[model samples]
Target: MMGFAVLLHVMAVVIWVGGMFFAYVVLRPVAAGQLEPPARLTLWAGVFGRFFPWVWACVGVVLATGLWMIFAVFGGMGGVGLYVHAMFGLGLLMMLIFFHVFFAPYGRLKRAVAAQDWQAGGKALAQIRMLVGINTLIGLLTIAVGAAGRYLVP
Candidate 1:
């Protein structure tokens, strides 16, 4: 059970963090270079609309498996080492940023897109990009902490 939970946790992080990297590093540049504003914005809206649901799933799995591992396998919060605790903290921070992005700017983006308010859509997209970038960095940091956490404990 613990091993399966760990697998789920790892997969969730991969999908969420890897997706962000693909978006930021690969897709964003190609889209910006190839597509005009209207097409680009539309593409982003559709992409995010599809992607956010997966992200939500990832968040759910991460939280569930993380808590399960900490408590069920590791004997609760007190037994978790500093590195795991740091990773947990970073993960929570990433989740909060994602929630803000989803509820706030993402809503605005969807509304602006629906209303054909290209300027507003563009503004909202920028905000989402900035927030995602922040989350991506945090996600990367969390991965690092998770990887090294076991060894770095003092």
Candidate 2:
């Protein structure tokens, strides 16, 4: 049961973090170089439409499995190490950032794309880009912490 919960948690993390990595690192540059603003915006909107739902689902799985492990396997917050606490804190921060991005800039991006407002879409996309960049960095750091934390954090 513990292993299963950990597996789910890791998979969710991989999906969310890996998606952000690809979007920010791989796709963003190619899209910007190849496509005009209108086409780029449309492509981003379409991409987000497909990706965000999976992110939301990943968020649910991560939260549920993480909490389950912390409680059921590790015997709750009090019983966990400093690394666990740090990971939890970082995870919550990442989730909050994601929620903000989804509700604010992402919402505006979708609307702008729908309305064919390239300028507005560009602005929204820029905001999403910055936020996702931050999240990706944090995600990488979190992964490092999760991987090496047991040995490092006393």
Candidate 3:
């Protein structure tokens, strides 16, 4: 059960963070250079339309598995180390940022695309880009904390 939890947790993290990395780093630049506003925005909207559902699933699995490990396995927060705390806090922050992106900007982006409002879509995309960038960095940090916490933390 513990192994399963860890596996699910790791997989969810990989999909979520890796998706953000690929989209922000690899896809964004190429799309911007090659496609015009309408196509690029549409492409992004399409991409998000496909990807966000996975993110939602990842978010659910990550949260559930993390908490399960924290409580069921380790006997809750008191049993965890400083690194675990850091990881948890960062994960929560990332979740909050993702929620904002999904609920606020992503919603706007969809509406703008439906209305063919490129400017509004652009604005929404810019917001998502910035937030995703921040979340990616934080995700990386969280991974580091999870990976190195036992060794480096208290």
Give the poorly placed runs of model 1, Cα more than 4 Å off: none
What is the full ranking by TM-score, best candidate first? 2, 3, 1
> What is the lDDT, from 0 to 100, of the residue 5 in candidate 2?
88
lDDT of 1 by residue, 1-154 (tens): 9889999999999999999999988999899899887888889999999999999999999999999999889999999889988988899899999999999999998888888899999999999898988888888989989987788776
Write out the backbone clash pairs for model 2: none
CA lDDT of each candidate?
A: 0.92, 0.95, 0.95
Tens-digit lDDT track of model 2 for 6-55: 89899999999999999999999999999999999999999999999999
Evaluate model 1: give its TM-score: 0.97
Worst 10 residues of 1 by lDDT: 145-154
TM-score of each: 0.97, 0.98, 0.98
TM-score of 3: 0.98
Shift of residue 126 alpha carbon in model 3, Å: 0.5
Off by over 4 Å in 3: none
lDDT of 3 at 53: 96
Candidate 3's error at 100, in angstroms? 0.5
